[model samples]
Target: MSKNSKDTLKISGIDTSVLRIALGTWAIGGWQWGGPDDGNAIKTIHKAIDNGINLIDTAPIYGFGHSEEIVGQALKGKREKIVIATKAALNWTDDKEKIFRDARPERIRKEIEDSLRRLKTDYIDLYQIHWPDDKTSIEETAMELEKLRQEGKIKAVGVSNFSVEQMKSIQHFTQLSAIQPPYNLFEREIENDVLPYAKEHSLAVLCYGPLCRGLLSGKMIKDRVFQGDDLRKTDPKFSTSVFDNYLAATEELTQFAKDTHNKTLLALAVRWVLDQYQGNIPLWGARKPEQIEGIRDALGWSLSANDLKTIDEILAKHIKNPISPEFMAPPNR
Candidate 1:
């Protein structure tokens, strides 16, 4: 890849809005923290921003705001240059603006204030609702978000973990500028509706878990038991029987990555998500500085149409079982 091509890709038809490769901070401040090796985590955060990663995605529940604090510390001087996207908790009542347990309007406002304080910034670039809450209607939550945007507290409004129907429901009330969904080689559920809806509406789709939570990283052994409170242990794909099969598939895919015009497995993984044309940007969570370097290495290059086709064929051949049965279904329903 050439340096000239860096930042050449756009996120949502916005010329300056290139792939906002986001760094998920949950690992830094949550399950992976205090594991005797935080130097790489902190170093990777700083390095990712320096490499033109404009977006950093985090949430209050990620170590209960510790992730935001870490991001703030990492972005101390360059805060204005990067976009910090965080989420409001998911427990607000539909009729009430205040969150009694998780996301009352008052609590949302308070949480935003606290997040801003911790981030050492005046306003957030994108403030997203973490997840849907049956207690509250998305309309009310979206209205509150719009209010905050108008007040200049948040520049954009986004949502995370919203299904196609849920996204359409919220769209009825407000312009949903963005959506963060877990999408990867193994997970193809969003392709049915979320991707098309986002494209039709000009919404930027920030994809989290782009590497299938490290399953597609071309790393990990069958006997690998997760240490500490890592979420991967609970993931169905990570089980010994399932993981071995996943690994074999990843190995075949990794070779395609190597042979198909020369990109690492990591690069190919990132490219697969970015290549999805629904204004997609892959949210890359790096625990080590080298991981950030791996992402950066993917920059300034793109997969050709033939390469993409080959990749599709390879995925179809190898990922036989798919992540889940629902993954094959259309999201429109």
Candidate 2:
């Protein structure tokens, strides 16, 4: 990935150019992480583009479609330059209590229109199924996406949080251009399966949680008190029993980054993710411009082969029991 945003990932079917890191709008929607301010969120989006990031990813369930609305409001008059990717198949109740998978053909027909209306664009650069719906077969889901592509509603088809088998199933019916998965320093399960499949199949890997939900940002402390609707308060890794272990690992990583490369933990983490594979694209999340200023520092620098080994050693020494990001998954209908 060149350790820089200068390199772009081109989906086989999409016409737009996407940077190495995409601007994630999950926090901007603000349902789980308190609430979002339109002014700040808009500025953040502009800053990300101003700083070389041209890809933006959002979902309808993010703040119940508020994130897509905010992203739509931010890209007025300049939508063509940015690669806008959004998801469907995940729906919530009117009261916003229960979120379940709904990848039925009828549901996708309505969801795509709603997303188009909210994104303020005629066609989405990349349209991804948020998650696989067990109730619906991959043939039905993939065929529906192909139909959308035929209609020009979306340029490329993608699936997030899908296993290798599921992706293979999807390919039998349609072209799969990308796969979005949660991957970070604290989480490496995808490295064993999903990444290899993407690499072998020529699919773009849009890696989410590159900063481990801000743990690799080096700003969270051991005694930090999470306020508001922040989802970290409920993350299993942030609980009392294991928080210290992860924090300790993060602290050591912070020191190693500074001592070895004179870089902040945020920059080092992004570089690490980019260096892991030749085409890995990390999705950087932010709610304010200031939070993303460090992304530039991550560019033009590659971590050494020895540096990766050191990181694994550090994690093995400090973290006794590691955990995956399974808790963040939505319910399957």
Best by TM-score: 2
Pairing residues by index, what is the TM-score of model 1?
Answer: 0.86
Query: Global lDDT for candidate 1?
Result: 0.72
Where in model 1 is the C-alpha error above 4 Å?
A: 1-18, 32-39, 91-103, 325-333
Question: Lowest lDDT 10-mer window, candidate 2?
Answer: 1-10
Q: What is the C-alpha RMSD of each candidate to the true structure, in Å?
A: 5.0, 1.6
Local accuracy by lDDT, each model: 0.72, 0.89
Model 2 misplacement above 4 A:
1-6
